[model samples]
Target: MAEKGKLHIVMFPWLAFGHMIPYLELAKLIAQKGHKISLVSTPRNIDRLPKLPPNLTPSIDFVKLPLPHVGNLPENAEATIDVPFDKVKYLKIAYDGLKEPITHFLKTSSPDWVFYDFVPFWLGSIAAELNISRAFFSIFTAPILSFFGPVPVLKGTQEDRTKLEDFTVRPKWVPFETTVVFRLFEIKRVFNSFTGDDDDVPDTYRAGAGIEDCEVLVVRGCSEFEPEWLKLLEEIHGKPVIPVGQLPTTVFDGGDDDTDDAWRGMKEWLDKQVKGSVVYVAFGSEAKPSQAELTEIALGLELSGLPFFWVLRKQRGSADTELIDLPEGFEERTKDRGWVCTSWAPQLKILSHDSVGGFLTHSGWSSVVEAIQFERALILLTFLADQGLNARVLEEKKMAYSIPRNETDGSFTRNTVAESLSLVMVGEEGKVYREKVKEMRELFVGRDRQDGYVDNLLGYLRSHRRLKLEDQSNGGQRN
Candidate 1:
């Protein structure tokens, strides 16, 4: 039996690092309150996770369940970082195979609540069978979730969105004036992902079922950022919509040592630059820009002529670790003012540096949180998923400036990229965005406010916990 007033919670995020890292953050937050946490993932993914704090080791446990073999999924490709973007469908196949083991685990351990991501659509039903409370924890922002609306709307029966044009406009359910809709090119990819027929388990069904089955809806943002959106989510879902805060990584949190040779060299280079003069470029772990787009970005960086440090990644859908080729002679011309790192660099340490002023990013929520935490200027260049929506929302908020691109084909020239980079980094036109983000930073970095959200969430969990018949003898009932 669980200790009095203590909860044993199970966290099961998707295989992607973006999802896993946030789940781990929540786990740590709960564990700090003397709750027991079991974070389940594949063996390899568990190995790649950042080490838990020494104090958390006792309360938080890593539960490994080996991924089942599936054709086309590369050997040992347990996480999205391991395989290319296109092969993630195969990874999903392997992920669904975990149902048996997870079900068995739940049957044995009987955690009070299970926090899960959208990928495991069926887990909710299993949790229901065991009378375990479950929450669909979304890493996406409130704006994106509000745009997608409720399960019935996403499931597409009444007033379903059929054509690509249907998604270009603001969703009717929003009930407020907002420009949080996807762009032409972005909607095409998002629409297909939501309604694709090639896979056995459609993402639309996963998202709808995940939402429908969960007892509550939890988002990764705060009411301060988008109060209206959070209210709209509660309206549409007809349940409590909780914002668990942005879950930003603390700057003082110890990570890789700066004395390491690679970090030392980068630190020295950054030290030489003027304060707030450098643009930090990274597209995060998942969103890989294509070769053509990368070439334009390279030439654009050269044209911008600003001091930069780009943490580049492999090409989209590539299985190899080798960095993709840049435009010929591109690196040589910019070598004096720019550094491109294909290998891992300490992102938080670099972002916190004095020389770093602006971030040219793919608009991932995690990346956005990091940028907002430091009050860095944002130059948005989105490639996939909810990133475009994020870019649109940030632009609407005047918190970031996006690169100019052809609306239909999502094509951008090197000149536009260069212009955007210059404008957001050093141009006078960027003052509004710079000021707005600085204002926003107060909320993002407020550790007290962040912790309060977690505390409130824990309180809700404690009050609402439905004890099984066996557990009733030990604690009676939560209420």
Candidate 2:
């Protein structure tokens, strides 16, 4: 603990912005509670962080490390939102190479604990070896985390991977009926490649990623939103699983004056539409759909005939294509019925707007929570890891509908896209899903009224700090 009654802590996050931002928010909250946080990242990302809160900035320390040489990633390419996929690979290499420095910092600085995102599998073990307690922080909601526990390992040839009927059928152990079972096989294939025999990375670097045992597992469980998976994680890990509810305060508070302007603009636009008449569409920061798919989605939105708002990134292409070109006059055609915001928007604010009837989303946990918190109906279109599982949960809960993508190739055709969007926007089934979402949203808001997530998280942190201090005192006396 610091002399001024602050607990000294360190935070290490994976290279991705989505993963890093939430963890940084948590750190900021802890700092508000009189804790000093040392955040570690590649030099590029550290340089890119929006300006920090004045008070928190001076209290928190930033540690920047070099990226390992991989390929043609430019030196200035650290914090740019448009980092290429190959560059992301290089950043991972850089993150991997910093194991020694990280371990050294853990050993020397000896903070109360360290927090890590997905990176080295051996992170927990390394922290243990350094005699430091560590926490595994996952940005995923509980249900998504629950699915990753022990499951029957499928042993089959590559050809067997394609049978949708075989894949959709549930494994005997998994307790849900899903049309999405085939999707799990796809994830398994990716996992296998990362852990396969031909891979140069050690098994320790691949399998389990050292998360087998952790002192504590921290989850973004804002709103008591994911109960089933939360219970499952407790059962699987046999450790304290802490759901630090949403830490709402940001390091960059969007400046003092302009913050209200974005909120006011969205609210004004939303007020003009009927209740549940507009669709909000946004792929998260890291997800970039192909130009063809982007066009297909746009056409689908045009077909749906609902008022909508789509948030698009300025540049498209990460690990996929170099440029994403939209159809001519696409923006103009939709201008009366829709608005497209460049770069980021006030996502939470938009979701909370009355005119914002439903969300056409990528099923990111953060976005999912926001939708639930505001009680907006959802149309799920997932593109990456665990998002499929999240989409399944929302669909199962009757709070959302998913676009049926081709199982073999993971493509969303126009018909499937149009129908799914309608299901959330105007269909009878869409109404039912919307009502269910309303119910869940009501439940979440009621819970928030009684016990807001931010306050709960702060209380947990204080309790955790006290528990650690007691444990240390007991150990000292015994020694």
- lDDT per residue for candidate 2 within 1-479, as digits (tens), equals 65734567789887776777777877876777677889988776887666687877877899887756555555555532557533454455556778888888788788767888756665778877665667778776666555444311211222223333443455443465444343743454334333334323522233245455356678876435666557766776666677776433233554574458776776787788888788998988766676778888888887777889888764633443467766788888887888887756878668767788889888877677678777788888776656777777777777788888766667777777778878777888678887886676555444443245545544555567677667778884110
| Each prediction's whole-model lDDT (CA) | 0.86, 0.67
Alpha carbon deviation, residue 303, candidate 1 (Å): 0.7
Question: Candidate 2: where is the Cα deviation over 4 Å?
Answer: 2-6, 50-59, 72-75, 79-81, 150-207, 222-225, 246-276, 314-321, 342-344, 442-479
TM-score against native, each model = 0.95, 0.80
Cα lDDT tens digits for candidate 1, 264-302: 899999999999999999998887877788999999988
Which stretches of model 1 miss by more than 4 angstroms? 250-259, 316-323, 466-479
lDDT of 1 at 51: 75
**lDDT value for candidate 2?**
0.67
| CA displacement after TM-score superposition, residue 94 of candidate 1 (Å) | 1.0
